[model samples]
Target: MIERLPARAFAAGVVTLALVSGVVSYLMVQPDPAVDTTRVTAAPAEVAASASAPSLVTAAGLEQFRRDYRDRFGDTLLDEATLHDEYASIERAVPHSPDRVMPYSYRGTFESDHSPTTRPVGTPEFDLDALDVPLLARYLAGAPQSVGVPDGSVSHVGLGIDVGEATVSIYVSNRAQENGYLVLTPDGRVLAVRRFEP
Candidate 1:
């Protein structure tokens, strides 16, 4: 009995430690401020149907985004007027989500409309005046080193935002075909875009 009591006490201590650790880890993971809570509502008393992404970005909206994305950005780098128009289109179509964004990918392919891919793998850290998208903008504005481009490349072309049935897509291209992926809020702030090859 004495031996069993010791074992039981040790097990209880381990269990308590594990529970506390899990809670601490969860709390430490700061909640993203871009998650949309506006869609949350009490289920109507009449019908029973609730199964979809909390935020419903429409097909038409995505289409508009695609259209806006048509013009390649990096070529001349969108002039202020063009950027304003692009922003206006986005503003009209997609209302900003009140919730925090949890990092989304603005993925697409970039070919012509841009310089040849020269940077093979590693290019020394430097700044590029890429596109006007939040991610690219943030890059040029703050973290230029965190960008993907071929050697000698200075900017990326901006393709409009495209929303597929499942994904919202924003395409940009530079010397590096796959320049980077962006984490954007509905309000159009680029949380971050990490440049990589692949």
Candidate 2:
């Protein structure tokens, strides 16, 4: 008779074959079908829809807003003389015309001669009508000026005006600490205005 293997050896050989077969079968199979790719798309339209609409404040309106804001907030925290000086500086920085007509509807003329050097702490209300438009526009366009809160102070003053249909913003440096101004139209319409202390 031929020689036979031991029972334990035969059983071990069978188990090894079964394990190899299982691994091979697993490797041959395809990936699962759960993944979905239909949701991807360009997001620009969605982003645009979510953004806030632009404001429609005009140059004239901006001036009025500044006046109202000054009248409302000036005395609580601004030196009158300092405010006038700041305005003078702004006037010097911008181009002026004798006719006082700004190129842009939102711009206004700035006058240094009439600027006030000292305002009573709580005397006259802040006047938007007094703001020089050309100077104000130039300032908003990033022209440098010394105005708002002083060097050591943390509070700074600013102006917000609406001209035609666009709202313009102006910031005064803490070092200058002067008064702020704005111009607005007659309709009393406003879009937006923001202020910060620096």
Candidate 3:
């Protein structure tokens, strides 16, 4: 009976320790009520939805954005005039070495037309004319199936001009998540394909 008593006492001690530890752990992980989380509490999905991404990657798209801006606030640079995504800028070749033409948002002056954004520049230019639009259309249509993302889930399409090559970045759902970009050349050549599973 004495031995059983000791065992019971030991079991009770263990149970008490466990309950205390669990309570401490739970309290440690809980968010502080005093902290303001209003600005930082956006869910992944909500953040994705709220993120500003340009719909088009061409010069025409740039024109559209400018037109929209003009329609809303005439001739004045507003807070929304900023290009949230740097990838939205298209690289165009200029005559001078230190002067490159790009959109106003991408380090360029606020101009309705593509204007020179001064930078140490290069020879080969992003050939917008050489882009195989028909081929790109077909590939983007099949990108969901080919890249293993949800069907018809193309969320954003942006352009990036790197090393004088025109590359397109396509986001399936949320670009900020584990899912990455489907990078392709303007000629419809696949550069990199990344997909999100969860």
Candidate 4:
């Protein structure tokens, strides 16, 4: 012989369990008010919007972005020249730290005065000190030709700094159409050739 609960008692117990689960789920989904949440753009292509932003260098926003970066990752040294491009030099920032286990990247036209957002990418792989603004400029000067873009075509370069590697995208286009881009290393090595179908 076994003892069983009445139907009404069983129904009440199920209802209480369901109510508790619902409340727990709701609490878990709510964001903590103490944390600062910034929007992270997943793709490097999304950074193209920075091109149209103001060209002025706002040190305040840039500094705040750096501070935010430090708060999140505890990174004290940032290498800014890594993101330099001849055309859009003022619209980029690259914050790097060797102490971090995972590599992180920030998105925004940081120099143009917008708030910076970050997302952890993957494991570290790049040599942090390999390139500077002058070196990057030299590579950009020759990137269009190496990628087979026309001699007089205009180009926009954006740098994506992964934890262990640096991916430089050189977007080229003529007066008529989009011509895709070239993926290059910080040292001018051609890593990939991307083609756009129009």
Candidate 5:
């Protein structure tokens, strides 16, 4: 004799079969584990040497040097009244010295409205005496010749001095509003003492 299955029973059996098949398929598929470690390496000896080297100038040393600079050349560069005036007018008028051409030993370039565009990148050393500015020539004569770094912008109190033949630039965050000067020297003597600002 033929037997007939109930509709509800037939549906329940089909659902159970599907659930079992899904569980078996998932268990059979497993992920593989691998990592790429190419960038990891031991440190170099030069890096270790650089990390251990001592600095040439310390913060205290720099302050002492600045104080010495003031004491030695302060009078020739600027008096108290002039310094105050320069500070007061620093925001308005900043004097730009003539383009100075020196040997490419120490070279730096900065952007300024006054900077000359046609100036050679690596100009040979020219005689400072040939320049019309006497103070600049004198400063170059007295100071040890070195290269000037590019000073980006003129701050409230910017200082430029000749270190050897190269110009060293300094910026003062707090300038007295009475008077000031831009002094350049070769052998530690004041070169050009121009009233930088008002």
Candidate 6:
């Protein structure tokens, strides 16, 4: 009976700790959806579509992006359907400004799963313009995950044209290991998703 008493006390303590932890977590995760629109002409759209975001570039969008890319550069090696399937599940799109002329950009956070001190919280851009679907499609198609995998290896896509240097890089989880970046062009033309060493 004495041993039982100790066990009961331990269980009670554990329950109390769990309750406290849950309450603390709930308090911490409560979101304050506040936005400052003092500088903007209009406030943010209240009916932000969570279902449609981060926006899936259709098969046609893919072709247009290819057209724009080809118009500016040359013919691309990327196929329309192949690119569409890659980013089909991008559910959340970070909001972006439309004044920018650059075609490629990224948004959101990427805290290194392996490193404690590394945080890739880039507010680059994810705002797809009225006709920027093709650009987004290009980026999505260029993602390594969009590529086909080999027998023992992961995604191995070799169908992109390199435009020398790029400023935008999107994160693509490389199986169970490192992350990849989809480098894009000004008009979302040339692209590649290569593994980045941490």
Highest-TM-score candidate: 3
TM-score computed on alpha carbons, candidate 1 = 0.22
How would you encode candidate 3's per-residue C-alpha lDDT over 114-146 as one tens digit per residue? 555665544343434445654554444444544
lDDT winner between candidates 1 and 5: 1
* Cα distance off (Å), candidate 2, residue 155: 13
Encode model 2's per-residue lDDT on 1-198: one tens digit a residue: 111111110000101111223222100111123321111100111111211221112233344435533453352211111122112112111122222211111112323334323322323222344545543332332212212233322121233222212222333334445433221211221122222235
Q: After superposition, how far is residue 27 of candidate 6 from its true place, in Å?
A: 48
Give the best candidate by lDDT. 3
* Prediction 2 TM-score vs. true: 0.20
lDDT at residue 184 of model 6 (Cα atoms): 38
Ranking by TM-score: 3, 4, 6, 1, 2, 5
lDDT of 6 by residue, 1-198 (tens): 000000000000001111223222100111123411111010111221233232223325334434544453343321111122233111111224222222221122111122122212432222222224434443344344322221112122112212322222334444555554433333433233234444
**What's the lDDT for all of these models?**
0.24, 0.24, 0.38, 0.35, 0.21, 0.27
Error of 4 at 65 (Å): 16
lDDT of 1 by residue, 16-62 (tens): 11122332210011123443111101111111122221111222222
Once superposed on the true structure, which residue ranges of model 3 sit more than 4 Å away at CA? 1-102, 105-117, 174-178
Q: Which runs of model 2 end up more than 4 angstroms from their true locations?
A: 1-61, 64-122, 144-198
Clashes counted in candidate 3 amount to 0
Task: Give the C-alpha miss distance for residue 188 in model 3, angstroms.
Answer: 1.4
Q: Give all candidate RMSDs, comma-separated.
A: 23.0, 32.5, 23.1, 24.3, 34.7, 24.3
Error of 3 at 125 (Å): 2.4
- Model 6's C-alpha root-mean-square deviation from the true structure amounts to 24.3
Indicate the residue-level lDDT of 87 in model 4: 20
TM-score winner between 4 and 6, please give it: 4
Residues 3-36, model 4: lDDT tens digits: 1111110000001111223222100111134422
All candidates in order of lDDT, best leading: 3, 4, 6, 2, 1, 5
- The residue ranges of model 6 lying beyond 4 angstroms of the native Cα positions read 1-131, 145-166, 191-193, 196-198
